[model samples]
Target: MRNLEFKEKMHEYSIWRANLVQAIEMYQQWLTRYGMDDAHRTNTLLNILSSLKNDRITLAFVAEFSRGKTELINAMFFAESGVRLLPSSPGRTTMSPTEIFYDAEGGSYIRLLNIESRLEDMSLAEFKNIPERWTQLELNCDSPTQMQNAFKELIATKKVDRELADRLGLWNEREAATQGVMNPDTVEIPCWRHALISFPHPLLKEGLSIIDTPGLNALGTEPELTLNMLPSAQAIIFLLAADTGVTKSDLEIWMNHINRARSAKKQGLAVVMNKIDAMWDDLGGSNDYDRSIKSQIKASATILKIDEESIFPVSAKQALLAKIKSDKELLAKSRISALENYLSNDILRDKRNIMASIVMRDIGSLINESVNTANTALSHASEQLEEFRKVDFHNQDMTGKLMAETRDRQSLYMANVENFQSSRRVFIVQAKMLINSLAEERINEVIYAAKHDISKSLTTIGMKQNIRKLFDDLRDLLQDSVDITNETRRLVKAIHKKFKDEYGFKEIEPILFDIKKYQLELEEVFEEGEAFRTSAKVTMTEQGIVVDKLYSTLVAKAKVILGRAHDDAISWSNGALSPLARQIKDHKKQIEGRLQMLRKINESKGTVAENIAHLEAELVPLKRQREELAIMIKSMQLEGQLAESS
Candidate 1:
């Protein structure tokens, strides 16, 4: 278990997740066993299971070129391979945004999207679904040399004429000017826009994925890396060379992408002062070396406006060599174990908590509902049994009275159903309005018009104005969606109150559909867009590149948010009135069964003892299910406490 903290934690995380999935499966079976499963609940549980099964703990590594970012990844996850699994040589190794994870369905391979794919109007997400366009390469996992050689393709570059390079957004005019190149016939561009590697590594198999982003140029070129990919990651490791501390480009990246809002701390963001081995001086003695390291940490903390503890000074090169050779002393000197500890305890734990919350929110509530239903059924069954024992089978008057009461309750149930149907009809019309307000087509229309305005505009100011207008329109649309949702909620409340007050249906509060979340997300995008619109880089970069980047990153991200909002609206529309309806239906069933039993007894066709026996039999499984549900809730509640104690 030497140098294996992160690996062990990941293994534990995977097992815990599997247990949660199993609990959901058991609940699904219980729902079916009790005849409580419906199409809506069934679909929701399936979606929850699918999400948990495919969950990944993603950590994105962001750094400028030659900061040993790739090497740090190698030392952390791939050191066990006894080689640098990802090519981490001196040059800009990760020219494209590369994602590495285990492929559950396929063999080890690298899927590279051609740089020319950027010319298409489609976003990177749209391109991912059409896999045929990516060039795929198989990796021989058994051969380290072969894998290393194959991975070099990530850094592969091709010489393209200046026109083509400019067209691809690779040729930076200011950079060219600084290098004193007046006119060059040709320039180099990365061969791929993105790389996806599916390797059968242990941690990856346990659902750990890594995103290694290239230098500033790559970040500037690809808006998806900032908008969709990095934001989605649970953690981000921003790398800096210990010798150079935060360089000018590093500051630019931090301000624009990494720590723009300084809220990255909440997302397991950490700064790695890599290549600290350079500061390991033999003549300086341990005390002097410690002071120098401490001073550098302080300086970096001040410059980055981050806590001192957030930065980890590590020698990734030494760590890799130390782990491969099993040199404990070298490993200790590298301070790699501290970073490993952070990953195992801080970052991974936070991710685990987030996923746990999702499971509880979705499955936990359903389990609670089922348990309550089971309890109610058992209680009713017990009452029936007790009353059956006390009933005089020979007395016609007693049986007749019970039969009349049952019929009266049955009448109430029928009236409740009719009223619900009417209310649902009205709600259905309102739900359509809510859904249409958040429709993809609606947002897409605005995006299309805004994109047109930006494309046709000749000035940067015009483009900025158009982009700002797009956000304003989106905000207005989202506000309309929220208003519609509130109206729908109010309607649902009135319906629930009618049933509860008139028909004696149990009070069930409705869940609010969250259009506000999307509104907040759109606001974040608006802020980021505003920052980009005002930044010097926007003016310096080519107009075409800026337009494409904005669409690919910010606009694309907004579209995704709107799409999800619409989907949520649909789900809410379907499930809103279902709880009250189910309650009414179950109540009717109870009454009808009681009525049938009383009629049988009054006719002398069935005995009171026989009815009691049937009720007792029905109560057994209900009690067992209640106990099982209690166990699941307890386990979920104790997860974090147990992990922390361990």
Candidate 2:
């Protein structure tokens, strides 16, 4: 099959490879001739060249506490192995970074940073009996089974006897007696405080690495892990409990962190509504299981402002069991099959296809071919120029021509950065406008409508209940509004914090300040109306409840009026405040553009500087080579002339 796209990419990669090879060869030749063999310099250049050619894809799993991050991972990959990478209990499992890489020869190996090897071989069961030195060791095994066995032996539950605990420095009688409880922090665990499990799984072998992160506190405490590793991830999957829906913490994470860090390329985010099984019991008579799921999905979708399709409601426990048993029916029933399909089929394969088609096939081949052609011409010209250098070359005609060509090519490459920067600015402005329109306008309208509609429903129910009960109900309804408003404020604060911290801008603060001012305005608007008071004598009658109909009607009317005002406030805030956000975003983009430009300029300048140095170094040798060639040619011509004269 003559695939033109593939052929083109291959061609580009080939040219890049050839140019890199040629560069290496030229450097080596220069070093050899000058007797300047600097191994360190050569190695650095080689590493830079190699990194340009190799690329890899990564997928990461992340979430808040009790979100089943580890369980979801187990369901996906470790089902057959029956080994949990992270602790699944109520307590925290992952205290530090644990990487699981595929080791073909060694089977599995745990590499510890500062730990000793002697303590690594002990089984998990024996861990409680071992001294502090045991937890310091790095453990590595060939098989998952072997690793699990070792772990079990090392953390031997049976070995948690008083003597063993005392010897291992886990038991403190005085502290325990006074405290009335064991201190988890002070207790020594046999398992490496940081565990790394590497095995040959089909998925992992295929370059699918899942990082099961610790709780929110741990993630926050470890900045390097989130800042470095999380950003590098090609895809991130966040899990939330289906029963709880999107909690305050979940919303905080989304608004503060994940949403801000998202990019169009190499960044995919998915939310898994895990533990769907829990919702099956609490659902009311009118709430069908599917309907309940849909409602939860809708609620979550509203909170996250994401498509319903993006949130996959699943049972991690059932999924794990199904995968372990290889039961397709169970997998399908658990709804985890959708997640599996998304990951294996949509995410992994889709990314590979795109990479193959775009980067590897098109850009790689094109750049490679262009570079190879340029290098071949440059190399040939250099050789020819050496010969012409000795004869004075009729006023340096040959050297002048070659220098002009090099300058022309370099200039063309330099212009592309400006073009890219201009296009990026335009795209960002449009994108910001679209985002503000949806987030501020559409969302505000929906929330306002919902609030008023709920208030109206409360008013209608007041006709049946006594005045006291009606007042209590109104209070409850108002409390719900207060709760929602508080939640929104919390979300806004989270967003504000992230914006200030990451981008060094106070973008959300102005919007939130506006919101607070608007809320006060709304309260003032409502206070102007008559307020309802509860009374004990107001009992229900057959005709109708003796509730304050006028007050109830006024409250409902106030909700509708204030709801519109709230929405208008949101609109005004968006209109007035969004420009600031956009400006910040624009400035950020500009900064990025400038940084990219600086990088390119630096790279180009570095290349040029290196080339100049190489040329300067070779000048003497090239002159000598030209001189030698000139002498030989002259001698040959003279000998021929003499022979003819004789």
Worst 10 residues of 2 by lDDT: 536-545
The true-structure Cα RMSD of candidate 1 reads 2.8
Off by over 4 Å in 1: 261-265, 604-611, 631-646
Residue-level error in angstroms, candidate 1, position 485: 1.1
Top of the candidates by TM-score: 1
Worst 10 residues of 1 by lDDT: 637-646
- Give the TM-score of each candidate: 0.95, 0.42
The digit string of per-residue lDDT tens for model 1 on 247-327 reads 999998898788653344545788999988888789998888888888888999999888899899999999999989989
User: Each candidate: what lDDT?
Assistant: 0.83, 0.48
Q: Write the per-residue lDDT of candidate 2 for residues 462-579, one digit (tens) a residue.
A: 5323333433443444444445555444544554464466534423333332234434433432332212222221222111112222232333433444455455434333332232
Clashes of each: 0, 30
